[model samples]
Target: MIGDPKTGTLQHARIEGVGHEGLSCSAVDGRPLEFALLDPTTGEIVEHGPHVAQEAFNVARQVYRNVMKGQGWLRVLSEPAPLTARKAA
Candidate 1:
């Protein structure tokens, strides 16, 4: 999930879903985006910022295994499951 952190209104990383089987995620520079969507025509963001961007990290990590195996397109889980709860003892 590591990519260019600064992408204007919505800062995020781009995953190519290529290369080696090994993949890792890390927070590069800058901070999490406060807003998820923006209006190009009006140049004004939505009143209530959607937290989808922030939730992406949690979702990705929760399905890291499927991603690494290139099974990201598959429906591995019906809903996002916290990695902490699935952590190995």
Candidate 2:
């Protein structure tokens, strides 16, 4: 619900499987603990806890986007081109 409202509109990582095993916690504390979401394809992982799931998911999504962009799999139209300063006349 929080974070980028357009997050749903953006392209998300193709996660083959997510490991929620890390969510379990000891009976002593009885508090929900952070857990990891594992993306089987690019190995992109993120840890989320309690009410912060949306934020963590967004972060992991960005990481995946960056990896794809770096690998030339996707291009950002808003990416700024290199700048070159002009010589003084």
TM agreement with the true structure for every prediction: 0.28, 0.25
> What is each predicted model's overall lDDT from 0 to 1?
0.46, 0.43
- List runs of model 1 lying over 4 Å from the truth: 1-33, 47-53, 59-64, 72-89
Candidate 2 per-residue C-alpha lDDT over 1-89 given as tens digits, one digit per residue, 9 for 90 to 100: 44554422314222222444212322234433344556789778643454344444545555668876787443233222355432332
Clashes of each: 0, 0
Best by lDDT: 1
User: What global local distance difference test value does model 1 have?
Assistant: 0.46
Q: After the best TM-score superposition of candidate 1, give how far the Cα of residue 70 lies from its true spot, in angstroms.
A: 3.8
lDDT of 1 by residue, 1-63 (tens): 488665334235432222333232323454333434458788776432334443445455557
